[model samples]
Target: MSESEQLMVVDEAGQPLYTATRQDVHTQGLWHETFHCFVIDSIKQQVVLQQRADQKKDFPGMLDITAAGHLLAGESVADGVRELEEEIGLVKSFEELHGLGVYQEELRLPGFIDRERIHLFLTDSAKPLTGYSLQTTEVRRLLAFSFAEFARLAEEETTVLTTVEGETIQRNQFVPHPTDYWKTVYAGIKAYCER
Candidate 1:
């Protein structure tokens, strides 16, 4: 859908308020729902990360969650699983995912006001990097990082020398999600992996 045509159900303090186009939502800093999924390889203790396509308007060429997108207006939260298939070609049903709970994140960047109620999910997979067929317009590449290192990375603002795909990743290269969001995600992933 085109930016102006893509509609989202905006909210106020997590309560649904009204519908707005994607452009309007961001431009106005309206609260909207988004889906985030973290693909983990339990056996290898690695977490999958996607490099955002440079053409992206926000945080282009940065590391981010495995797959994510805004929830369309009238779309059920469970329907968010489509993001997995759309971004990385990794298909799975909603039932197969482990819920990490919803999180609230906000950031004001220049003219963009981002206030989001995010539905986070986690799934452990043994799939290799080459197994993913990335949507080049949304994601540039996919790589796996040590799960332990990722957890540490989320805990603080320091950059760690983590090599993936023969390239080193620094904290500056990641989307600057709030510390609380990272903490919640880390806790959820830890609990899920331990289970």
Candidate 2:
């Protein structure tokens, strides 16, 4: 229940249920949907990461995918292409996106158990980062990090991820995560980059 985000209903088997407030099914630990887009380098060795805006409901400004947003109610996963543009000002089409498989995971934090079905995609944009208009409320800053550096942060627990506006968030120990599902997304992207 982020005011900017939409809520949806789903079946017991995880199909679309209906749209509801975050307070409704959220208490029951059901899953939701999101769209993730990672902007990588030409060689695909680096990823453009965004710090979440300080105003977000979760994680806020911690290191996250290149660009991500909730899939609004009644929206298609394909619509995420537009979200990437609207949120980050990167106008592109599906061809630029290398659709990774949809991923599902559970998140535990601050008295909330968030289950999410994430639609992931990857693309390399040589576009200048400066030319983009940022959705300041959703992203505060952008940084490009090397895969090696990201690995070191996660492995060594050295990198302290904060929202683009500089709000820190404590993470779960059992998952060994840096920021939410970063480790999972990074592992997948790193594997993709290596090959």
For model 1, the superposed segments whose C-alpha errors exceed 4 Å read 164-166
Best by TM-score: 1
Residues 1-195 of candidate 1 have per-residue lDDT tens digits of: 357755565665567777888889888888899999999888888889899999998999998999999888888889999999999999999999999888988899998998888999998789999998899999999878776677766567567648445577778888989767777878888898787
- After the best TM-score superposition of candidate 1, give how far the Cα of residue 105 lies from its true spot, in angstroms: 0.2
Point out the worst 10-residue segment of candidate 2 by lDDT. 171-180
- Please list the residue runs of candidate 2 whose C-alpha ends up more than 4 Å from where it truly belongs after superposition: 1-6, 11-14, 153-184, 190-195
- Each prediction's Cα lDDT score? 0.85, 0.67
Q: After best superposition, candidate 1 residue 10: deviation in angstroms?
A: 3.8
